[model samples]
Target chain A: MAASAGPEIERLISLLAKLPGLGPRSARRAALTLLKKREQLLNPLAVAIAEARDRVRTCSVCGSLDTSDPCAICSDNTRDQSLICVVEEVGSIWAMERASAFRGRYHVLGGLLSALDGIGPERLRVEDLLRRAGNGEVREVILALPATVDGQTTAHYLAERLGPSGVSVTMLARGVPVGGDLDWLDDGTIAQALRARRPA
Target chain B: MAASAGPEIERLISLLAKLPGLGPRSARRAALTLLKKREQLLNPLAVAIAEARDRVRTCSVCGSLDTSDPCAICSDNTRDQSLICVVEEVGSIWAMERASAFRGRYHVLGGLLSALDGIGPERLRVEDLLRRAGNGEVREVILALPATVDGQTTAHYLAERLGPSGVSVTMLARGVPVGGDLDWLDDGTIAQALRARRPA
Candidate 1:
C-alpha cells in the first residue's frame, strides 16, 4: 500500500484487509491480482457483491438467509415440514446442509444463551420457534447446536419450552466422530461415545 | 458450497476462490462474513473495487499503476529523475517504496523475459526504459530485477540495450537480507554475502 500505487487502490486494499482470513499484506496481494485482472476478476466480483447485496433476504419463517422471504428450504414442499433442525447460527445450517444428512427445514437461534455475554433466551428466536412448534405441523425438533455448555443450556431451555406444544425434542448424538481414532479422541468425547453406545 | 446458500452466494464464493490466497472453503467463509456485515464490509468493499476499476491508470512514463497518468512518483519533482530503478513488475515498485530507501523514480518492465513462457524483449517495456534513459535528464539506470536466472538474463539484455544510450547502468547488490538467519541462508546468498563484505 504505497502512495505510488494511488489512493483508490489503497482504499480497496484496506477494505479487503477486513475480510475473515485476509490481513494487510494478503489484501495488498489480492488487490494487485484484482487490479491486474480487471476485466476477468475485478468487475465481475464487484457485480457479484452488488447483486448479492441487493438480493439477499432473511427468511421470516425459518430465520435463514436466501434471496426469497421464506427461503428456499422453507418454501420447498419436498423438505419435511414436520421436522425442524435448530442451530446456533446461520453458519451451522450451512454446515448441516453440507453434510446432506437432514431432509428437514431449519430454525436459526442466532446465538447460544451466554449469561456472561448477556445473551438470554429472549435474545434468541425462542418465541418464534415455540410458535412454529405449536402450529401443529412440526412433530419433532432437532437441537443441532454446538456441544458447548452454553449450547446445551440453550437446547435444554428450548426443549422445556417446546415440550408443552406436543413436539418431541431431540439432540445431536455426542460421541466420537465417524472416522475418529480412539487415540486422537478427547477424554470427554470418548466418555460420551461409551455412554451413548447402543445396538448397531 | 451447500445448495441452500443459493446460486448468487455460490457464484460469489467461486469467484472469491480465484483470489490469491483464498480457496473454495475460505471463499465460502468470506462470503458468509460479507453477508453478515453487509453495510460495514460488503457494500463499502464493492464500492471501493468499482472506484479503483474506474480510476486506475498505468503511468505513461514509468509503467506503474496509479490514478494519474504520470503516476505520483513519476510526477513528483523532488525525487531524483536522473536515477531510475527498473523492476520486473508493479508489485516490486510497491515493495521498494515500502522500504523508503530509494529517492528516485521507478520503471516497471511488466514482466521478465521467459523463453519457456514465450516472453521476449518485445513483450516487456524495454523500449520505454531505453527512451527514458536517453532523454538526457537521466544519468543512471538501476536494474533492481530478481536474483533468479531469468531476471539476471533480462538484466544483461537491458544492460546491453541501455549501453548505447549514454546512461550508466548499475544493478542491485547481491548479499544476505537484513534480519535473515545465517543457518537458514542458502549457500549462494552466504557466498555473495562473504564476497560483498565491507570494513567495519
Candidate 2:
C-alpha cells in the first residue's frame, strides 16, 4: 500500500518473514534475492509450490499426506498387510519411508498425548487406530513415537489397548534420535529400526 | 488432485518446498507438522508472510529492499554526502548497516563484472554510478566488493574511472573474510572497514 513498495515484493516479503529464523529485514533481503534470481529460483520454486500444492493429499486410512487415498504403501500388494507402523505425525512416516526399510503400512497418530495440553486419546484418532487394529488382519503394530515422556506414554497406552487383540507390538530403536521430531532424523535412524527392531 | 491429499496439507507443502534448503518430501513433512500445529506455527507464519509481503519494497536510490523507497538510511540527512560506499549487492549494504559504522550513503552495483557470462559494466549501473560520483557531493568512494576475482575486477575498474572525477578512492580492509560471501560476514568486519580502510 505504500508508494515505495510493489505488490510482488510485498507478497514475497510477507511470505518469507513467516519462515523460521527470518525477521522483517531478512525477509526483505530474501525477497530481493528471489526477484533477482527469478529465472533460476523464483520461477522454479513457484512451479514446484503449485505442483506440490495441487498434488499432495492425506491418506484417509492413516492420515499421512500422500498422492493416493490409501497411499503407495497401503496400496502395494507386496507390502505386509498384517503390519502397521504407527507414528506421531506424517513427518515420522516420511522418515520411515526415506529409510526404505519398512515394508508395512503406516498409521499417523497425528500427535502425541500430552497432559499439559489436555490431549486425550479421544481428541486424537486413537479410536480410529483401535478400530483398524480390530479388523483382525494386522499381525503387528509398531510404535514409532518420540523418546520423550509424552511419546512413551502414548506408546504405552496404545500397546495396552492393542495387546488384547493378540497382535505383536514393536517400537523404533532408541538413541537413533536426540530431539523432538522424527522428521529431523537422518536416514540412518530408519535403517537402524529395520536392523535392531525388537518386540514392544 | 490425489484423493489422499487435502487442501491444507497441500498448501503447506507447497509453501515449505519453496524454501532454500527444503525439497519436495521435506516440504510435505514441514507442511504436515505446521498443519498439526496450525494455531502455533502455520497460521502465524502465513500472517507474517502476508504482512511483510505487503510492506517491503526496494529503495529507489540504493536498490536496497525496505519498507521505504529512499529507505531510512538514504533519507537521513545526517549521513555524509562526501563519502559514498560502493557494494556489490543490497546484502552487503545491510551487512554494513548492521555494523552501524558507515555514516555515508550506499551505491549497490547489483552484481560484479563477469566476462564468462558476458556481463559487462553496461549490464550493471556503472554509468549511473559514475554520474552519481560526479554529482559534486561525494568526495570519497569506498569499494566493499567481495574478494572474488570478478568482484575485484569491478572494484579496479570503478577505481580507475572515479580517479579522474577528483574523489578519493579507497577499499575495505582485506584478509578478514576467507572465501566467504560478504553477506555472510559478521558486523565486525564491516565495522573494521571504517577503522582500517586503505587507499584503493
Candidate 3:
C-alpha cells in the first residue's frame, strides 16, 4: 500500500493517478509539483476543474462534451452537417478535429462494441446514430473508428443498420501513413496499400 | 496554438499540462476523461485540490508540507530526534517516507547548489539546517541528495560547513542497487560496488 501524504494530498494524488497516462509515482510527483507551485498550478487547476464540472454538458444530439447542449461543431453553420463522422469516444473526435481536415459534425459512440468487456451497442449511442441517419439530413456517415476488432465490429454493424436507410456509409482508408517510409511499413499495411492502390 | 475545447475545458487542459508527467496531448485526454466521468472524478478532484490548497502548509522547522506547522513526521515523538535526513526537495522527503525505513525527521534544502542555474546556499534552507545542527540535539545529519554533480557539490559544501559544528555529517553510499543486475549496471555503479565489497 502507498503511504498517505496526509488525507488531502493523498486524495489529490489518487485522483491524479486515475488520469490516462499517469501512475502512482508520477501522480505523487505531480502532487508535489502542484503543492510547490500552489498559487500558479494547484489553485488554477482547482478553479478550472470546478468550472468545467459546473459548465460542461453533453451535446444532446451528438453526445460530444461541451459547455452547450449542442457542441461547437454541431452548432456551427459553416461545418458540413450532411457529413457525420462516427468515433469511438469524445477523445477520438478531438483527435479528428486536431487533423483539421474534416469540417463535419461528429457522433460519439462512447465506446466500441467489445464483447469481452461486455460493452454492447445498447451501452453506446448506436440508437441515436441510427435515428440521425434515418432523418434524411445526413448524406454520408464516415466511420473514423480505430482499426481494431471491436471497432471494426461496431463499424460493420453500423454500416448494416444504416445501409437500408439510404445513407452512404464509408470508413477511413488503411495504408502506409503519409510521411511514413515504405521500408518501415508493416506487412498488413503493405497488403492494404497494394489492395487499395489508386490510379497514378 | 492549440485549439480550444471551450474555455473551461481548455483552461483545465492547460493547467493539467503543467503537471510533471502530462504533456498537452495527455492533458487533453485527461480533460476529456474528467468531463466523461464528471460526477465520479472531476468534482471530487476539484474538491481535493481546493482542500489541499486551503489546508496544506509547509513545516516551519523541516520545510516538509502537511496540514500542520511541524508536519506529521516532525511532530511524531516516536521518531528519532537525534537523526535528521537532509533532502533536496519536499518530493524527496515523500519518497523517503514511502520507503518506510527511515524513522527520523527530515530537512528540505529547497534545491541543490547549481552555479549554472544560479542556485546558491542562500537560496536554500542551508542556514536553517546549520542552525539546527548547532543546536546540540542532532547527533547525525544524513545527506540523502541525488547522485548528480550538483547534489555532490551541495553535499561537500554541507559536510565542510557541519564539520566545524561537531555534528557528524554522512552521505548515502553509492553502490549497486539491491536487486540490480550486474550486466545492466553502469561502470560507476560497478566500480562503487567493487570498492564497497563485503564478505559473505
Candidate 4:
C-alpha cells in the first residue's frame, strides 16, 4: 500500500477509514481533501481532535462529554433544573436541543439495557440518575429513550428504581413523527398514532 | 452548538464535519465513535494526521506526496523508467497501481488546463512533464487522463508539445469498462468503443 499510495498518505487514509460512515473510498477522498486544504482545514481539524481527545471529559453530573467537568448544560443555571430528560446517549441530548423545544437538564444513560448484548442497568448510569432524581430539586424524569425494546426495558427499569422518589416519571410522546406519512409509517407507529389521536 | 453539544466535543464534530463526504450528522457519529474509543482510535488518528501533515512532502521528481523527496515509485530502479504515464492527480497513480498493469514511471500534471476555471498549462506541471519527457531516456509518454473536454484538450496539447521531443505519444484505450453494461454506457463511449474495436 505504501509503495503504491505513499506511506504517510496511506497511513492517514487507514486511520481516517476507521471513522464512522467513511469507507476506504470515502476515506481516500477525505484524505485527499485534507491534503489539499492543509492550512485551512487539516491543520485545524488535527488540532481540534487532539484538543478534544486530551481535554474532553465526561460531565460528572450528567455523564455528557465536555471540556469542563460539568458540561455546559449541567453548568447552565438558567435552564429548568426541576426537569431531567433521560437519554440513551449524549447524541440524544444534542438532538433534543436541536429542536430547541426542551429547556431542561439531561441524564445520559450511556447505553440501554440489552439482554443479547448483556448490558444491564448496572452498565448504565442508572444509580447516578436515581441519585439525581431523589435530590429533591428535580421534579420530573422524562424517559426520552428510543421506542425499541432495549430502550423501553431500560426506561421501565429506571422508572421502577425511581418509583420510591416523589419525582414524576414520564415517557416521550409516541406516535408518527413529524414529516411521516400515514401510509409510509410502520405498523407500530401507525397503531400508536391511532391510539394517541388528537382533535385536529 | 457548544452550549448544547459541549464545547470540546462540539468543536471536534464541527471540524470532522468539514471532511469530504461527511455532513453534520455523520460528523456527529464519527465524533461519538472517537470519544467512545479514545485510546483505540481518536488519539492515534490525531497523531497520524499530524504526522502525515508534517512529514509528507511532494516528490520533486514526480510530484507525488510521500515521506521522501522522490516518492517510492520515482526512486524505484526496477520499474520501466523508459515509459512515463502522465496523470491529472496523485490519485490516478494509486488507481493505476491498484490495477497492477502499469509498470512505468509517472508524471503528475497536478491538474488539467481548464479555460472555464482560468487554469492554463503554466498553472499545472506541464513544463515539468515536458522536461522529463525530453530528457532522452523516456521512450514513450502515455496520456492517462480523463475523457472530458478539458482532459482531452490537455492531452492533445501535451502530445503536440512532446512531438518535437521525438518520443512516441499514446493514450489509454477508451472502451466499455469491465462489468459496465453497454445499455448503461453513454453514446460517446459506445462510439469510441466501436471505433477502437479489438480483434476479439
Provide chain B TM-scores across all predictions. Answer: 0.95, 0.76, 0.97, 0.94
Of candidates 2 and 1, the better by TM-score: 1
What is the TM-score of each predicted model, taking all chains together? 0.91, 0.66, 0.97, 0.94
Best by DockQ: 3
Instruction: Please give, for residues A1-200, the per-residue lDDT of candidate 4 as tens digits.
Output: 43368767887889889988999889988988888788988898889888888888889999988888788888898999999999999888888888899889999989999999988878889999989999989999999999999988888888899999989999999988889888898899988888999999
Worst 10 residues of 1 chain B by lDDT: B1-10
Candidate 1 per-residue lDDT, tens place, A8-52, comes to 887888888888788888888899899889889989998999898
lDDT of each: 0.89, 0.72, 0.89, 0.89
Better of 1 and 2 by lDDT: 1
How much is A74 displaced in model 3, in angstroms? 1.6
Predicted candidate 1 versus true structure: per-residue lDDT over B1-200, tens digit per residue: 55657888888888899998888778878998899899899999888987888899788989888988888898899999899999988888888988889999999999998998999999999988888899999999999999998999999999999989989999999987899999999999999989999997
Model 3 steric clash pairs: none
Candidate 4 docking classification = medium
Residue A157 deviation, candidate 3, in Å? 0.7
Comparing 1 with 4 on DockQ, the higher-scoring candidate is 1
Task: Put down candidate 2 lDDT per residue, A1-200, tens digits, no spaces.
Answer: 12123444555556556555556676666666665565565555555444444565667888876666787767789989888999888777656766777788889887888999999898778888888888989988999898778999999999999888888899876545455366777666666655877787
Judge candidate 4 at residue B96 and give its lDDT. 90
Off by over 4 Å in 1: A1-4, A175-191, A194-200, B183-188
Better of 2 and 4 by lDDT: 4
